[model samples]
Each structure stands twice: as C-alpha cells, then as structure tokens.
Target: MPTGNTVSDGVGAFQSREQIILKDKKQLDCENAQDDDNDGHYKATHPTSYMDTMLHLFRGNIGSGLLAMGDAFRNGGIIFAPIMTAVLGVICVHAQHILLNCSEEMYRETKRPKPPGFADTVSLVFAHGPVKLRFLAPTMRAVVNAFLCITQLGFCCIYIVFIANNVKMIADQYGITIDLSIHMIFVIIPVLISCMIRNLKFLTPLSMIANVMMAVGVGVVLYEAAQDLPSIQERTFLASWQQLPLYFGTAIYAFEGIGLVLPLKNEMRKPELFQKPLGVLNVGMAVVGCIFISMGFLGYLKWGEDVAGSMTLNLPRGQILSSVVQALIALAMLFTYPLQFYVPMSITWPGLRKRFGPKALVAKELGYRAIMVMLTFVLAQSIPELGLFISIVGAVSSTTLALMFPPIIQLVHEGHRNRLTKYIVIKDCLILLLGALVFTTGTYESLSAIIKFFRKES
Candidate 1:
C-alpha cells in the first residue's frame, strides 16, 4: 500500500509541473503577440514613403539657414562658395553613409534593432565597443543628448531672431515702430502651443503646409533678386581669407541635416531603400545643395555685398509682395519651431518624467516646453544677431554632431581588425581634423563678430 502511494504522488507532481510549463508558454506567446501588434500598429500609422522621406529631409535642411546662404557667400565669394558647398555636400553624404553602415553592421552582430537617432547611435557604439570603453557608454549617450538639445535650442533661438528681424523690418517700412523683442513675444504662445504636441508623425500636415509657404516665399525672393542682377565682372571671385571661417560656419550650418537622417530612415516604409545608390538621401541632398548654391550665388551676384542677414530681409521694403514673402517665411518658421523642438523634448522629457512620475507627464512636458520657448525668447531679445547666432551654434554644435561623431563611431565599431582599409582610416582622420579646425576657428570668429556687434549697439 505504501509503494502504491509513492507512485501516485510522483505522477501528481509530474502533472503539476507540466501544467505550470504550459501556462508559462501561453503567457510568453501572448506577450509576444502583443508586442507584434504594437509594432504593426506603429508601422501602419507612421510608415513614410520614399518621396515623403525625401521631402522631410529637404524641409529640415532648407529652413532659415538657406536664407542666410547669400550672407555666407559674402565671406567666401563666388568661386569658393560653390566649391565649398559641393565639398560639404559630399562630406555630409559620406558621413551619413558611415553612420548607416556602422549601424547595420552592429545590428547584424548583436541581432538587435538598430539605433534610431544620433545619440542612440553613440550609446550603441560605446556599449558594444571595446571592453574598456563599455563603462563610458552611458556618459557618451548623455553627451550626445546634450549636444542635440543644445543644437535644437540654438535653432529655436535663430528662428526667434529671424522672425523678429523680418517682422520688425516690415513694421518699420510701414512707419510703425515696434521693438524686435515685442515681435518675439508675439509668437511665443503659438510656438508653445505647437510644442505641446507629443508625436512627430502627427506634425506631418503642419510640415507640409510650412513647406509650401517656404517654397512660395523662396520663389518670390528669387524673382525679386533676379530682376536686378549686378554685373558678374563687378563681383569678387574670392573674399578675404580671414573670412573663410565665417563661411565654414554658415555653409556647415546650411547642410547640417545629419541629425534628421537616421530618424527619417527609421520611420520609412522601406528603410532599406534609403541607403541605395541614387536613393532618397542622395537625391534629396543633391537638390538641397543645388538650391543653396543657386540662391547664394544669385543673391550675392544681384546684391553684391548689400544682402542682409536673410535674403527676405534684403527684399524691397516698399513692395507689398516683399512684405507678403516675409510674413509667409515667418509663418513657415513658426510651424517649424515645434519640429525643431521635438528632438530636445524627446531627449529631456524622460528625465523630467522620472522625477515627476507618469501621472503628471503631460503637464510636466507642456510646462517644460513653455519654459524652453520663453528661454529662447529671452535669449533672442538679448542677442538679436540672427546671423552671428546661427553661425556660432552651427560651428559649436553642428560640427560635432555632423562631422565628428560619425567617423569616431565607425572606428569604434570596426574594432582593431582593420575591417576598414588604411586609406579609409586616413580619410576619416582627415575629416576629423577638418571638423576640429572648423569648430575652433568658426566659434572664435562668430563670437568676435557677436561681441563687436553688441558693443556697437550699446
């Protein structure tokens, strides 16, 4: 009887263990199915087509910076401006390629999802890199995030100055005197409301409207500029060599779309097509470079050292059409403020959320954005030098984000196996050197110019 009881107990235990295993398996399967559904929902709602990706790239790059290209040409002159534009274009494209290649290789090796942004890429590189460097991965991620936040905020500051200057110019033309700071204040509420939006995909309609306004504004400005083209013989082919640093700052600022590249790629309906030969990036950047070159060359040729900080500002004040263009461009940038602010908010909000907890997330986020807008408004009021501010930010933040990080990440990812040829390594080193040079020199030049301007104003 005892032997029979022992057999029966063993059988009951085995059956219980099997039941537990089956329950666990079902739970796991359900969780996986839920994850798959979430991913599918995301793709369904946010999938961007090839052309849409191209448009987003263009929209991001060809902002207020494009209007400043003519001023950039004033520093580099005709010959150097076009040449440097092309060179920078190629360098920007190559740097993007390096980033994408490294991302793909890392994804393959780790069998993980590729990084989705510039900061994420930096963190991934350091995390999966040499054993010694793995410890610094979190710090490096913070650094990249800091740079991105600063860059986007810098953009906000520039937009404020841009809007203020243009609006003040129009107000003055009508014999209405209002401080630029007041104009800056006028747009704050609108910008703050726009920043309340949490999802980037939802901003697509606003982006499209802004793009149209910008296109129309550019057309009007170009038409106005072309009507009074100065003699080619009269214009200088080369500028003072000392001014080259300023040119580097401005042109680099114009092409600083590297931050947007990966995000655009990650959101695409068919991401693989983004990296193909003659793909979205290449085509989009090519068009962007052409637009910059043409605008700078033609505007400078027409104005011949008389162009203002923005091409729109240089438009005839007496013309109603010029006023209309200014307003349109201002509106375009007004809409773009949120798009630019999105990166900084995404980076900074998580920390804020952690501190405040999930229950108050929306309130905290909106409050944070409002504070950011007010801060930018105050800075714009203080400095009020749109061109100089743009150059300084581009030199300090854009150079690091666009030119410095990519090659370093590539080297780290490739390791010591010399997977990259010696020639490639040498080339990357050269690029790094160039970035460092631009950052140091351009920063100094921009700061000096700003200080002098402020002193004069005082």
Candidate 2:
C-alpha cells in the first residue's frame, strides 16, 4: 500500500534486510558523538535525515490496505468507524512505543554489537527471563518471524487481488470482462519476475514511481468520495455484533506497520526524536490517522452499504480519470510487490540458506522466490474476495504481531526485571484478551463471509 522515499524505508510491511543493513554494516565499526547515551554504538551510524524518517513512518503505515477502511466503516457504522479508527491508531502507536521501550531495555541489558531485529528482541527477552521460560526463546523467535512471513506474504496476496480487481474494473468497462481469479493468474508471472530483482538499489525508482502514483490515486479517491455525501443521521451508529469482528480485522489491517518501526528508528540520525509527544511517531501517526478516518468516513457516507472492498472501485465508471486512477494505483502496487516479497524472502531465506549446505545458493534462492510468489498468487486466486481476505489476514497475522505479542513481551520482560506490577498485569491481560477475541471471531466471520461469497458466485 505504501512506497517510501527510500527503497528500505518505503516499499512494504518490513524493509529488506539488505536495505536496512546496507548502511548499518559500517555502524558496527564507526563511532558517533553519543558519548553519554546508551545506544551509542547503534546510534553512531546516523545517516537518515529527520524528514526522511518521518516520510518513512508515514508511508510505512499507509498502504493499499488503506483503501479498505471504507468497507471497514460499512461493517461498523458511519459514526462508529472513525471513532474506533482513532482509538485503534492510538493503541497501535502505544504498542509501538511499548515495543520500543522493551527493545531499549534489552539494548542496555544485552549490549550487543548492534540493535536487535524484532525476532532477536523476542528471543533475547524470553531467553533471559525466568529459567522455566528460557526454552521458549527459540520458539518465540520462530513464531515472530513466521508471522512476519505470513503478514508480508498476506499483504502481497492483497496487492495481487487489488491489482487484479483494478485491472478487471478497467477491462470490464471496455467490454472485456474476465474472472478475478484469471486476473490474479496474470499477476503471478510479473510478480514472480519482479522478485528476481535482489538489488535494493534497483527498487528505488520503482518505489518513487509507486509513491507518486498512489498519492495521486488516493487524492482522487478522497476527492470523489467526498462528493455528494449523505447526512450522518441516516446511518447506523453501530452495526450488529457479528460484524464487529470484521470491522476489527479491517481496522487492524489498516493501521498495522509494526515491523517497520524498529528498523526505521534504528536507521535514524536521532533515534530519540522518534519517541514521546511531538515526536515523529506521534506526529506521523496523527497524520495517518486523520487520512484513514477521512477516507472511511467520506467513502462510507458517499456509498453507504455498497462500498467496494476498495473505495476506488466505487468511483464513477466510464470516466477517464477513474480508469487512470485504477491503472496507476495498480501499477504502483505492482512496483511495491517485490519490496513486500523481499521481507519474507529475507526471513525465510536464512532457514533455506542453512538447508542449502552450499548447493548452488543463488539458484536455490531464485527458485524459492518463484515458489513463494506463485504461492501468494494462488492464495489470492482461491478466496479472491479482497475485503474478507484483508480482514482474515488482519485478524490472524496482523493481530498476532500487533496486539498479542507486544503486551506479552512486555509482561515477560517486566517479570524478568522484577518490575511487574498489578496495574501492568491487568492492562496486559486486557490487551491479550482483546487480541484473542478479534483473532477468533474475526477469522471466523471473515471466513464465513468468504464461503458465502463463493456460494453466491456458484
């Protein structure tokens, strides 16, 4: 959904390992002017500018999943959606800070060569905790990386369907109707080819193009969505209990960019600027929040129950601007797919690299990339219901990464530090409970909705 100023900062859910570490490899040896600071080693290599960091934060949090906020609103209500979005945005921001705080504690504790990746932080926290739980360290690390794969690949699946849906709409307008699955099949080859591009440098131009196109496309969508809106009094304040999970799933998916946080902060010149009030995280997320709320509010009031999975689809047909917007955004996502694929590939490749045992490593990596690309295409083709698929992924993978993991990590780490308190326990328990509720019910409802969609199609 989002592309950044830098390939590493902008392309997808998580930055490419190569992209993130390309500069940091020097940081391991170079010295910065943080003589009194704890993160002196890591912060020593501060090449990223503040404005660049803010842009990365904003772009990282906003993406193709953003367009679905309208359908999310349709599931909740006209009034309820915006309020919940603001609330969720605040929670997501808090979770990021919780994660940042945990990592800061670990940075001081471990005093390793460099900053820990998400997986490393989880492992180190659990491994150093109470002895009984130490054995779970590897498992927790695997779980975090596994969900990273699932979450990014899930976003790739979304991009495929999104691109196909946009293309199909254009074709349908020209009397060239085709099945959505068929459109996804067409996406597999190009996406597969794009994944072969291993150089992060090569992705920069693509990212730039994608960002510009998406900016224009979203502006047009907002413009069209704001037109001829109905009164708020006519819409429901809240939807039925069954639809609440769907809304939760969609909202989570829309707000999540958790994996990008640490890497972005670690890459910054002043990592301290990323935290607290008036910081980049707060300011950027506030902007992201307003945009999301506006998109949902206007798109819902403009289209009500009939809002498509992407509000872009609900734009007036037969208009050249509409077709151009669709095509442009579709192409933008096309450019972003490789960046998205790179994260999972980075995580999944390390295991595969160990498995290779020196049997033509490069060739094996390329082949593995192809299989994963096709895998996303196949998954998208199977369900092919963009809205429901977004919800399911949000409910399952995004919820795990965002809600379930952060609080538990904090609790475990706090216990290890003898800092655990009654209030912390209570608050963490509530977050975990909410995560569990959303994961179970949202997955069930979204899957049921997908089933019904297929039944109706048949």
Candidate 3:
C-alpha cells in the first residue's frame, strides 16, 4: 500500500503483464481468475472473505504516507490537524463510495458480468454517460491512466527520497559523510534489480517482508514519539494560513486510497458487504485515520516544529532502537519498490509496444525498466525533500485522482440516468473546489520551498 502505484507489471527483473494494484493485488488477478459462467456473470475462484477484504483495505490505504503525519501536524498545528483529518477522512471515504457506486451502476446498466478496473470504470462511465461526455470516453480513460502513472511513479520518487533521507541520517550517526545524493545513487543498484523482477509472485514474499518491517517500524516510531512529549499549549492549535495547504496535501496523500476500494470490493466473496454503514472500507479507514491522528498529535507534541519528514527520522540519535527503526523503514521501502514501479510501467509500456514491435517486449521492457527506475532516482535527487515531495505528489496528482475525478464521474453518471440533483451538484462541486484549492496552494508552497532550498544547497 505504501508502494502503491495505484496501478493497482513485468519480463526480466523488470517486466510483468500482470496488473498488481497496491490494494495488495491487481484487479486483473481477480478478473483473470474467473471464467464466464452460464449466467454471464464472473465470479472469483477463491474470493476474499469480509475480514480478508478488511485487511487488504487496511494494508492498501496506510503505509509510508502515514509516517509523515507528524510533519503534517507541524504544518497544520495540533487541534486543527486531527479535526481536519477527521473531516477529510470522511470526505475521502465518501469519494470511495461514489467511485464504487458508479462502477456497480455501470455493471448493472451494461449487464457486464465482469467488474471494471478504476480506469476502465472511468472510460465506461463516459461511454454510457451524458451525451456530451460519451465522446470523451477514450480521452477520460487515458487521462485516468496517465494520472495513475504519475501518481504511482510519484510514489516511487517519494520512496527513493525517504530511503535516502533516513539512511543518510543513520549514516551521519556513525560520522559517515556520504552525501544524500550519493545514497540515492547507491539505491540504483537494488531498485534496478527489484524493478527488473518480472513476476508479481516473487514480489509477494518481498512485499510480506516489507509489511512486517513497516508494522514494526511504525510501532517503534509511535512508541518513541509518544514519550517525553511537551504540553498541548506549547504548539499552536492552528498554524499559519500559508502552511495549512501543505497539511492538506499531506493528509490527502495519506488518505487517498480510493484507488484500492473498487478493486477490493470487486474481488470480494460478498461485494455488497463492502458498502454498508459498517462496511469493510469504512471501519478499516476509520481505524487508520485514528492511527494517523494519533501519530500526528503525539509526534508534533514531542518534537514540535522540528519533526522530520518521517517521524522515524526524528527518533533520538545514537540509540539502538532509533537506528533499528530507520533501517527497518528503509528496507521496507526497498522491498516494495518493484510493485510501485510496475504500475506506471504497465500503463505506459503498452503504448510503446507498436514502436518496439511485438517481438521486442522483453528487450524493450528491460530497457524501459532501466529508464523508469533511473527517472525516479533522478527526480528524487533533484527535489530531495521527503515531506515536501510527498505533498507535491499529493497536491498535483493524488488530489485530482482521489477528489476531482470521483465527483465528476458521479455527476456524469447521475446525469446519464436523469437523476442529477441540485444537492448532489452542490456537494460534489464543493469537494472539487476544495481539491483545486489544495492543489494550487500546496504546489506553490512546496515548489517554492524546493527552489529556495536548492539555492542554499547548491
């Protein structure tokens, strides 16, 4: 989930035809596993149970992004961070519901036994949507997939930056003087091999290891952050207006797991159980939100304005426990690298198939993998700010994908059915505006900070 391409794959170490989403698995896995039955409906050979779906939902939504909650609180202040996080959490969950409902509506309308992936749903919604929007189906699909590529690759960039930042901090503890950029360059070794990994099956074990490491790492981080904390009055309840958007970007990126919802629900043994008042998605997200709120509150209370991009990096230096957490988190990101890389690689690689010709998929993919992996490393080296980098991706891409699109799709779908209500328009419009605001302000502040930092660093 932390490494989620939201593509949510490869040949040699770098090629997969499989569509493995960070919902933990690709929607294609479930779809491809089922055969067309006599009733014309598709069913999974081994569908996931309610609890299973809940676990997937939890794993998919929360990951490295949660690690930044402390920094986000630094930006938003204490009281407002939790309050706004709760509000945004509810909106994010509602967006997921909107996406799921739209996809199900498409299935019922078209009588398609198979449930569509997120991008497919966008295309189909447009195709069957209002007359003006029907012509935009292909365009919409490409747009959705394009953002998927951007977001997933963006996640990869953040991973590289995060790994480099923490590892460099640990290296500093031992009087090691390797520059941050050098650490990122060294990352090229394993990331290339991992990205070249051709099979999703192989990544499963690596991903499991990452999950375990992250669990331990996050637990250690939270435990340490909660200790020797300052009084509530020490930190502002509301931060400066300019910094609030960074908080929005951070929180949205952490919560925007809407991409995982449809894919998870589609593969469930009882899909209806997914959208109930007490559904898997709701309960899981609720718990994750509480964790995020707690982490932000505690981390900020502990470190105040000085918290690092990741709380793990803020642990007291020279302690074995602190160093262990840093190492675990770094290793966790490394293992998950391949899964995130394959997402955008899968989406864009197909478009280049004709250029490379059919016979060259393997060689072509090998070259492509090298280029994409390097690109992520390059981007990370350039920006080199973990918390701000995460905010930029969340602002520019995640917000659009998670917030902007759902409302638009809902409007189009509802309009297609002649059920478009004024309240619906008003509600969704407000959400879209909120997303736009975050995108604009967050992008401005993050980019400005990076530029200023580069001027000083260089």
Against the unseen true structure, what C-alpha lDDT does each candidate score?
Answer: 0.73, 0.79, 0.79
| Candidate 2: pairs in clash | 1-63, 1-64, 4-10
Judging by TM-score against the true structure, name the best candidate.
3
Reference-based TM-score of each model: 0.87, 0.93, 0.93
Show where candidate 2 strays beyond 4 Å: 2-39, 44-46
Residue pairs in collision within model 1 = none
Evaluate residue 78 in candidate 3 and report its C-alpha lDDT on the 0 to 100 scale.
95
Question: Which stretch of 10 consecutive residues in model 1 shows the poorest summed lDDT?
Answer: 1-10
Quick one: how many clashes does candidate 3 have? 8
Give the lDDT of residue 22 in candidate 2: 20
Ranking by TM-score: 3, 2, 1
lDDT of 3 by residue, 101-206 (tens): 9888876777664767688788889998777778999888889888877888888898888888888889999999898999998877889988888766678777
lDDT tens readout by residue for model 1, 1-458: 00000000111111211111111212423432322233332132366788877766665666777888888888889888899889988998899888877766654554443233465567777888888888887787788778766777788888878877888888899998987778888878688788888876676567567667878998888788788676888877888866788888888888876766665675678878888988888888899789889988988888878877689999987889889999998877777677666656766776677788878778777888889888888887877887687778778988887789998988787764357778778988999999999999999998889889989988
Error of 3 at 443 (Å): 1.3
- TM-score preference between candidates 1 and 2, better one: 2
